[model samples]
Target: MSTDQSQGGGFPAQQQEPPGLTEEMRPQPDHGEKSYVGHGRLEGQVALVTGGDSGIGRAVAIAYAREGADVAFTYLPEEEPDAEETANLVRNAGRTPLPMALDLCDRAACDRAVEQTVEGLGALDILVNNAGYQMARDHSLEELDDERIDRTFKTNLYALLWLSRAAVPHLRKRPGCIINNTSIQAYEPSTTLLDYAATKAAINNFTVNLAAQVGQDGIRVNAVAPGPIWTPLQPATQEPEKIEKFGDDTPLGRAGQPAEVAPAFVFLASPADASYVSGTVLGVTGGKPVF
Candidate 1:
């Protein structure tokens, strides 16, 4: 609520196992619940946001519903409680919310998610590839094991590919759009986020290339590259010491809330607002450059 840039100036030192929960957060991250007034920007749309259980995905799902879209979203099976809460938020917005528990690393599951959205929601208008994985082992290349690398790549990159491919046919029918969730880490690489950052970079390339390929069909593709926004990912992925100083280095000097980032996704999804906007990476960072 205060743009003073002092809120969450530095987080209280905390940690959580991977895939943290919102209720477990110290100062819970905002998901634009009481805020974010809508103006029918995405009216009549049907959106599928991966990882809609919490964080940026949750915020986007809520915003989309408020903007008049029936929404379907995915989350890890273990995150069902969080997923239910997100679905409730969507329902509060007077839109249908289909919450599915999924393991994105499973390629077949990714395909099934797209299929379920199409079948359940009636039509697909926006696809937000927002689910991702990151862990800060702070390990050297030698210590970063193959298993972790595989999981990171599979979750962040492979799932995007699988889901997008499956959704393309449906997207083509509605001349829909695809919005990928990338990160500033793609440009400013962090050694600890080696695999994650690499996948984000690949996502950027994929977004632009896909836009070009789909433009003639009236389908737009783009990405949102967020900086150190406050999300479950931070507590779960960053070292505890890093968490205390999270987002302090940003020009804004505080971590952004999920509410702060949802507008970007809203803008990119609304054809009225961004019909000509394709092959673009909208940076919602707190003054971090994604270039």
Candidate 2:
């Protein structure tokens, strides 16, 4: 079995896997499989996490489970094994893991995901909007394709709005919370990820506005803006050369692990840790500037 560090990058020539999840992925992502210590921060709550099969989503799911919340997660059908692994980790942490496969880019699918999560887990006390996609390009503004821009916006922004809208009814009943996965690039835009960065900025705005709108209903909404973290999206979307140097140049001098960022979700979900917190964006970008 390959250790976590060995699975970083550089797979064998014979291994060919899909973009989302592959059995041959080296150092398979650490989904809190064997390591994740919990402290019961979220006992008796329910959480729904999009893209919860791997990366930060997986980490959050496991952490939520360990912290005493049953979790419902979404992933593509093609990533069944990885999704199952996440569910299993949640089970090991003593929480039920309801894993569903759905394409969140569709409004109907987003609604269904929220519905199914509520049906399976009883009620949703927390929502983690963590699914996203990005492709790097060094093109000028004039060269950017309209389709790519639209797709990025649809996946990163529109789906979030749709899902949040659908879940608000249930959230209102229980006085729940939402935590969006924004990116550090929202503040420090990358030349290659223009559209992606724009969507993240929009996410920030949406989170703040939603928090204010729902505060009267007792629903807290916040966001987590992570900087450079080692996740599958890096290798799936970037060039191999760029992959090799992932997270090396961050202010922290290294990319953060998903485990390191998952705690923020736990903190925001629990009223004990964040009773007065709402409409705020917690910066977890390895010491990056917020402005």
Number of the predicted model whose lDDT against the real structure is largest: 1
User: lDDT per residue, candidate 2, 157-220, as tens digits?
Assistant: 9989999999999999998999999999989998889889999999999999999899999999
| TM-score, one value per model | 0.97, 0.91
Local distance difference test values of all predictions, in order: 0.90, 0.83
For each candidate in turn, give its C-alpha RMSD to the true structure in angstroms: 1.3, 3.4
RMSD of 1: 1.3
Candidate 2 regions off by >4 Å?
1-18
Candidate 2 clashes between residue pairs 3 or more apart in a chain or in different chains: 7-26, 7-27
Model 1 lDDT vs. the true structure?
Answer: 0.90
Q: Residues 143-231, candidate 1, lDDT per residue (tens digit)?
A: 77899989999999999999999999999999999999999999988888888889999999999999999899999999999998889
How close to the true structure is residue 174 of candidate 2, measured as C-alpha lDDT? Answer: 91
